[model samples]
Target: MARSQIQDVIRCQYCENEPAVFHCVPCGDELCPRCKVFHLKSKVPSGHNIVRLSERLHPANQIKMCEVHSSKAYEICCKVCQVPVCIMCIQEVHSEHAIGKIQDLYEKLKAETIEELTTIKTQLKSEISQRIKDYIMGEKGIKTSHEDIREKMKKQAQIFINDISAILAEALQESEKDERKYIVEIARHTAEAENFEQTLDQMIEKWETLTDSTHPVELILYRKQNPDIFKLLKLPNKLSIVMPSFSVGQINKSQNKHQFGKLITSKVNLIKSPVESSKHIQPTMSAKGNKSKKRVLERSVKTSQIKAEKRKLCYMACRDDRSAYISGDGPGIQLIDRSGTELDNISTDGEPIGLAVMLDRSLIYSEYDNKVIYKVALNKQKTEIISTEHNPGGLCCTKSGDILVCMGYRGTARVVRYNSTGRKIQEIQTDQNGERHFSDPFFICENVNKDICVSEWNFLKSKLVVLNKSGNLHFTYDGHVIASILKDRFQPSGVATDSLGHILIADRANNAVHLISQDGDFLSYILTENDGISRPYGISVDRHDNLWLVEQEKACVKVYRYL
Candidate 1:
């Protein structure tokens, strides 16, 4: 029924030059002999329901369409065959078929269609009602979950306040005990001084009387009684006391702020407490609640918190699986073994952000102040590499011995690769739409499959962007969520890769390191805060696959068995 068929004289759809000898109903196409064979052989199967126009010449059905030759008009019918026919079909295709007018069967067909609609309507009504019931149940479940979460958070806040109050009470108790001892010592010294003062006053009075009376007997008596008293007065004061004072410090300020209590005195001013938490009238945990709670209170307290080996390690790069070079909270980059033993140190001019290894196995490290990525010789010599147009953040060495540098300025970012000789090989910047991908890209590394992975953080989110060897995008990975700290998002600072293609990223906010697959899927995490990891900054894997963590606040590097 297309208007094009009227003006175009019904040409074959397959072979446009030839008049269509037949129209195929199922295909909605007109075809000549050659194209019809191609369609019948390859395009149509026994499955296609088609009508030839010559066979559909009855008036009622003809206006609709032919079963095979679907578009042309059929003007004749063979009464003996009871079938419709066109000129070519009557002669070559359906010469022996009986034909009839389709107008004669229209009323019966229309009646059948109306009857079928009733059955479809009844079936559709039941499905719609069931779907509506499911939607209502789903809505109720969502609201119930929201209500449960809101109530739980409120309870947690109250529990947190109780913990803080307990710490304050305990710290105050320590000061009180010290004050009581000071008061007792003061009272004892005051009583002894009064007795000495009394004896001296009496002796002086008796001496005055004896001198005025000129009596040798009276003077001798006073001298004999006061001689021992004078000796006692001349002796050093054993009860001398310095004033009582109390000192306090933030307990693990960089770690858990919730549990804090420091008892400071002159003899032990900066000593850490033996107890991990303060004594409190704690609420008895419900048997049901104990199974799921993972807050700091629920976790077991370690006896000795692991501190750093030496100065703070803010940045780290692996020399091998056993040792790494670190920089932070100190001037020089110190090489330390897996056990945190200092092996070597290379002095740097400023605070460093990241480090990498070059093809020559010489160390390359980036500092916060400079545009150039500096290289330190194994012999402790220093030299400047190429200067970037922007401040460099992360340096990662590719297997080809080339270096990939993260560069950015004015809140924009890109990655540039350079050969060992300071020649820029390629730059990977914007996406296909020409928008920069990073807010503040910090550390980067390469996966075993040659995918360059970059860790980036801004106020909004901390995420990783991975690119293939040719700088094409692979996927982005955001850090995993911690149920204990639901309000705070994960932020990555340090990045590293293990031999098994697992990526490790250090998070300062959560005090944990996130482990992810090489293809950017989140795997699991190493929770350090529970084990007393404070402000974990720099991260690296040693040759034995032990994880080296820089405890920033404690100014030390701690190692762990991660493999």
Candidate 2:
């Protein structure tokens, strides 16, 4: 070889004048391309750890597996003990605890936090902006009206008016504080989310790339390695916006003296209950029906069917993300994704019949035989949240996070409300006349106005019952009375409400879904057998106002855009 060429060539481990690329760490040899291939192929040096010079190891990216159980990865975490535990460790010590895979837990937490973050952006943020705009826009009118009224009123009346002005000012300040609190929370949460999201993205990329590649040794070595970035998920910002109320009521004569009447400027947490609804909310009981049809109603028709397993769908509820849940005929509650795939199957003691999902994805279901209500956690753990005296039927979670269950049987039917922890808060049985409001109350739902709608069924009396939040019988609807059509009783099985204050009832016998206006007038038959809906029992409306009707006999959930 020439002297200059020989000097330029990096020597292989076994020979000189050979250009080298890879360094075998275990063999401690900088190998040329041919030697590296030979080393990987040879029996003695085949298992050596090799790395390219350009790909030097970073200490920060290195992960350590379980030390005690050498070579075993530690993927699972014992939440109760607050420690990382390997699968072997779970069988040894951390058995029967709230154990979760670090990756799974992080993803779940991220999804929830992101959902809330989106809510803050879309609903809370938009609502605050509109509220400010409304208040500001109305300020000029309010000032002009007040000034004109002040000239006409006495000094005491003017003082009362000034008091209202002060109240409005205080309301503005409270709203500003609310807006500022949300702004800070969003900023802090965004920063934290960005950091964690980037870290997770890199980790997931590495995991996917390495796991998919033919690196058996590295895969085996890091099989159970769990990242400690899990703590970032627990630090999620639970931003809840509490909208304030600023009301200026009418001035009524009391003891012939002028006073600031009903200045409602209470700043209440909106996450708990309904935010600032006007007193014009009429109970579903007193729902005044309109016989005259003014506007042409757009009915919901079956657009497509969800590819689910069985046709015997007893009851179903749509989650916030449009995922439909149903109780399997046998054991466990089934969670179906948007593609109709059973993403999760949670085992329970017995088969739950009626299922309901809260806004927060809390799956509240009822056990048919036992008449019990349960809340299903993310880890497939079942917690008995409500035990009813009567056999509980369908379950629904109110906007205030209260659980409403159909607790009744033949001859005695009623609706009952309970707190989260299986505690019965109140029971509604007979109405003001001491007469039973329902007979065989099966399915129930709470409206935006907190009204309870029950589908009461019996061979003798089949009717749809609607009561106000206070248990007052507002109205009772017996199916659409059309003698020309020769239809039987309503025999409503499933009930749900839409954003437009409309009550939807699924009638299995009639093979139709009756749309009732919020005021209790029969809007129209939104769905029928003609619309590819037959034996439609369990039904619900998704966020997009699309009707998800489960035809039990057909064993499918059909989606339709009505509203």
Q: Rate the local accuracy (lDDT) of all candidates.
A: 0.69, 0.73
**Each candidate's clash count:** 27, 8
| lDDT of candidate 2 over 10-71, digit per residue (tens) | 57766655777777654567787777777887676225567774453543123447865776
Error (Å) of candidate 2 at residue 387 is 2.6
lDDT of model 2, residue 447? 81
TM-score of each: 0.44, 0.49
The segments of candidate 2 whose C-alpha lies over 4 angstroms from its true place after superposition are 1-301, 483-486
Expressed as tens digits, the lDDT of each residue in 127-214 for candidate 1 is 5587679778777876776687668667776787899899899988988998898899888778887887887888788668889977
Residue 326 lDDT in candidate 2: 71
